[model samples]
Target chain A: MSDSPIDDLIQTMGLMWSADGGPRIAGQILGYLLIEGEPRTLAQMCEALQISKGSASTNARLLEAKGVVRRVHPVGSRQDGFLAVPNPSHSLLKSVAKRLRVQADEISDISARFPDERADAQRRIADFAEFYRQSADFMDEWTARIGPARGETAQES
Target chain B: MSDSPIDDLIQTMGLMWSADGGPRIAGQILGYLLIEGEPRTLAQMCEALQISKGSASTNARLLEAKGVVRRVHPVGSRQDGFLAVPNPSHSLLKSVAKRLRVQADEISDISARFPDERADAQRRIADFAEFYRQSADFMDEWTARIGPARGETAQES
Candidate 1:
């Protein structure tokens, strides 16, 4: 643990993401941005998170593509800034639901190729496909109920 | 892709799993069992899946631990068999919900250590914690609504 609680928390985020099979430095950059609640340049992120400039830039862009971070141009600022998006989990959930739909489609495609002798197997595959498809729909509904996404005004439920 | 559609499907499964950062052999074993919908010995799995005994055994055990496959013993049979669990996605979803709960706890713990000057950061952390906690509960409810697990009789909805 570091002397600063903030650093300790950032390390925890890094470790947690690594445990989930993600890059540790990406999680660290996310943690730093989330806690700062402000736009930071690539150099600033590299300095504060103690990560290499290349690592910071790469991960920040990755996070931006994933919808958890944004690239911003502050007034009169020469360098671009990175800021953590509000409700980052929503985007992650969206990707997961998309994956489930893909799995469902793949399962259905495979099920169509099953031999006549494996009728039971086809039935089982059908059930699995249905489960994944339904799960994707459920996830989409759940995320919708979570309210607005980043930079959007809240709407009436 | 292989000439046999079944083999092609299994290869697809392996590729998908590897893409997701999981063991490819495990996904192949799962695809084999899932298509057969019957228990087979490790030796049989190795021979049929064209995998080594070590890879087949280890990946089968790994799939078993993940609740996607189970070890079974046919009556009067000396050797054990591994069968794909019905509705395996339910267990995977359960594990995901459990992980969300862990994340919520970690975020809450870290939020407590933030200094007074970072009240806005604390609020954002609280929002994230709330999101994770609610998501865990939502996943649990959804999975519970998915009907029976492995070997259980279907109940009237």
Candidate 2:
């Protein structure tokens, strides 16, 4: 294990997110920001992680676009700083539900294109679509049950 | 769109599953088998998908291992046949819950390594772990609610 707890956490998160198809460095940056609990300039992050300024900048932008990270500006500092966004879990779940809905819609459209004679095949496709649609609906309900304010309160306790 | 509805469905499923980090060919095979609703020999799958026998066999084994597809043997048939496994959505949700549990465990272990002075970081890590843990629990409850028999009955209507 690394001497620094933060370093270990960053590496672990990087691997975890990479398993879910995200960029490793972006995950690390998010991990670092979450642990720091304060905005960090691109230069500072690059130095801390020993990565190039270009890589750090690129990933910071990507993470921001994903709604898990945000850019902040200090009162007098010219350089922009980045921090992990609050309520990331909610954002992630919402995006996942959105994607699943798109997939379900596509499956439904494809099923409709089939002839009535292909009932079995059509039924299978419809089932697949329903599965995704239901899963998305479940996410919506779950999110409402665990709304951001309540989630934060739960975490504080 | 292709003249064959099967082809269009397979392509759409291929894209959807590939986005979730699964092999595109494996998704296509799963889609094809689900629609075919009958055991298909490896050669037939390859011919229909215009893929090599090697690729078809490899993806079929992969899907089978994932529990989304099953191998079937007909009486006195020399060649092995494959079909989509029943209750695949249940299996998939269960597997996802399992993976989330593993992630939560990892996060917990990492949190234990943090020093007392790193309280903020430790809290954030613990919160992250909790999110995954709760999500896994949700999946468990969801899976039980949609058990195989119930799921099939619902689909029939």
- What DockQ does every candidate get? 0.55, 0.64
TM-score to native of every candidate shown: 0.89, 0.89
Error of 2 at B13 (Å): 1.1
> Which docking band does candidate 2 fall into?
medium
Q: Per-residue CA lDDT of candidate 1, range A1-157, in tens?
A: 3667688778878887777667898888888888889998999988888889899888888777777787889989899988888887678778778888898899788888888998888888788778789989989989888855766222211
Query: Per-residue lDDT of A53-152 in model 2, one digit per residue for the tens?
Result: 9999999988876667878889999999897875677767777888899999999998988988998789888987898999999888887878753222
Listed per candidate, the RMSD to the true structure in angstroms reads 4.2, 5.0
Instruction: Quickly count the clashes in candidate 1.
Output: 0
lDDT tens digits, residues B41-107, model 2? 9999989889999999999988876667878789999999898875577777877888999999987
Candidate 1 pairs with clashing backbones? none
Taking the candidates one at a time, how many backbone clashes does each contain? 0, 0
Model 2's DockQ score: 0.64
Q: What TM-score does candidate 2 get on C-alpha atoms? A: 0.89
Give the DockQ-based CAPRI class for model 1.
medium
